[model samples]
Target: MKKLLILLLLPLSLFASLNIAVTYPYIGALTKEIGGEHVDVEVLAKGNWDPHFVVPRPSLITKVRNADALIMNGAQLEIGWLPPLIRRAGNNKVTPNASSFLNLAQHIELINKPNSVDRSGGDIHPDGNPHFHLNPANVITLAEVIKDFLTKLDASNSEIYNTNLLSFKEKWEKKLLEWQTKMESKKGLKVIQFHDNLAYFNKAYGLNNLATIEPLPGIPPSSKHTIELIKLIKEQKPCCILHDVYHSTKTAEFIQEKTGIKIILMPHDISALDSIEDLTSLFDYLTGAMQ
Candidate 1:
């Protein structure tokens, strides 16, 4: 094929370039940062579509099918949509065991793994909490993973990926320190969450998670749970009740009606809301809500 020959004859820098596809905007944004200008990234899902609730669109299918590599957060964060997309992408490069297939959750410690293995027990991730992105430290770990992945897939430019990763990690680490300081100075700031999804973020901010609005992570927030949340809010007197934007506003509205505490809606991912387009904006809006 003429195109294939062109690809081969191109310089290592040119040939090493790739079209990467990611499951969500957050991962895509990070990959773009680490991959730099060498890779063209296509984010499959929009931010508001709860990463767990994505319905693969034709565009996403096309992107995945044509991508040289597919990057994901793993840990079942994509259980709902990714599997179908992978099948649809029809890209052999993304198949497990392929050199270009990278699962970012690799080697990261997971929390809240289920003891049982039955879906009938309610929606559960046997792989544990997939909310690792909420913590900036995990991002640092994953950037290295991406850096390595890119280098392996395109070894000629290994130094570029490595350099970008180091710079990004250094920048992110400094920001993390400042955020930790902000959280520590505002100590004893407890809060109740709509679900356990915000655990890592709460931990990062040093906020005390007194309780959750849902008894179980995947279980829908119920009347009984809200009653419990109201009591907990009364007892802890948290300045805010943090809820992801994808959650039911009615439940939050009801809670606000009974308890006069402010309910803060934060994006759980880069694309969680329309205006919260990128990582910096997402962090800025979320950090602002905490303030």
Candidate 2:
């Protein structure tokens, strides 16, 4: 009986899953999809919270400390909160220099890179816009990157990871066509945004971003700037204000009262809104927002 019990537990230990810590909900979703039963994901930030201002809680440090591998959005999106968690966690596996760590931003080409950096310009990402995941096409690229990373860490399950990635890419590519058709009519349409977080989305769909509600990146809206924006909206006659769920829509609402423009709430990631549950649904909500 003792020999039989030992044999039963041997297979379980041979196929133990990896614990992956991801910086945001979307990355967690992607890792889980590719990892399937081979891995467990721990998300650090809430999708509904401001990605730039996540609180570095003690719980997050513990998650990082226990993770077998770590993945982050990078491009300085988590610059304010992530580093501290990694430092306090004291997990060599989660550090940037470790082989168990992955930075998704390095794989994707970032847009809106500032020519120069300065504090006077409000918050600016030196490597261009950190919100590259907004583009649906980029999502596919990220899926591939995650697949490769997972395979490297667990080659024994490489076949399963490859199959999952292929299924994801096939489904995603079909949805891409559907989204393109849905957004084709809105191409070249002018719009306003509370912040330029949707830069990649706008570029992907050919939507023109006239201006941002905030005077500068990471800066709050001001009365003077609000007045100026109202004037621009009236003059430009943009379709609507694409507002992010995390930011206060007060400034956009005021502009609406002044100009009669519409405000559409755009969620940034999984759980950003109740309806956004996964990667597919996240893009579905985004592409269907205009309708």
Candidate 3:
């Protein structure tokens, strides 16, 4: 009878995993990779939507409220939506200052910080670009940060997280080298984009972006700006228009109609397209899209 009782209790102990909530799909993927079997991750934002424009739905409040910890991309990427959810959830552990809260952006250096903070700049991030995860190197660094975070949060599972971290690093290092080689031939290639969403990606491969279809970040396309872009495309003869998934392709299609330039779809996150399932696959698709 005692042996039977112990066996029943064993299943309950095994289910004592930590519940982690993340603001983006990439963070959720990284947390799961490091947390292994010791955590249950709840992602608040859909991978298909704009990372900066996630809706803080009531359902997300439940996710945040129940989470034992929270991890976010931060750098004000969540400024538009996460705050309301956090406020409503009333989960102190997930608050900005809590030890249980991890902001991945603080650990990495961001690029393209605006010279001035104003609506005129079209929704610029004052702390710089928050899309650091698009860079493979930054992803590796974030992975280590997440591993350390999980280790500290659940010390009993530190070994598992550490082991997973080492394995992930090995695999990622190899893939990085492969991507570097793949992108080598495309260096110094000029491109255009609807937004500067691919800034990190462009920097990674030396893809020069002459201009964007949008007059400024987060602003809709204007006919006057489109005319200017059409003129620029004629003069610059850029390789292609790198358009993000969530945004409409109408402007880019119009540009292509005018200039005969190609428009390539660039996905910013996993599930931004049906084919992009995970971190490596996301980068793989981006690198492959260069052609």
Which of the numbered candidates is closest to the native, going by highest lDDT? 2
TM-score of candidate 2 versus the correct structure, residues matched by position: 0.96
The lDDT per prediction is: 0.80, 0.93, 0.91
lDDT of 3 by residue, 1-291 (tens): 999999999988777999999988889898898898799999999989988888888899999999999999988888989999999999999999999999998898889988777865557577788888888988889999999898888888899999999999999999999999999999999899988888888898888989998887888999999999999999989999999999999999999999999999999988999999999999999999996
lDDT by residue (1-291, candidate 1, tens digit) is 999987777766564568998888888888889888789998888888777778888887898998999888888888888888888778899876788888887768887787876777566466888888887777788778888888888777788998898898888888777777656666668887877777777777677888777667777887887888888778878887788888787887788888898888878887687788777677667766787
At residue 71, give the lDDT of candidate 2. 95
Rank ordering of all candidates by lDDT, starting from the highest: 2, 3, 1
Residue 135 displacement in candidate 3 (angstroms): 0.7
Candidate 1 lDDT trough over 10 residues, lowest sum: 179-188
Q: Which residue runs of candidate 2 sit more than 4 Å off their true CA positions? A: 1-9
- Candidate 2, residues 1-291: lDDT per residue as tens digits? 999999999999788999999999999998999999899999999999999999999999999999999999999999989999999999999999998999999999999888887866666566799999999999999999999999999998999999999998999999999999999999999999998889999999999999999887788998998999899999999999999999999889889999999999999999999999998899899989987
Model 3 deviation from native, Cα RMSD in Å: 2.5
lDDT for model 1, please.
0.80
What's the count of clashing pairs in each model shown? 1, 0, 0
Candidate 3 lowest-lDDT run of ten: 117-126
Query: 2 or 3: which has the higher lDDT?
Result: 2
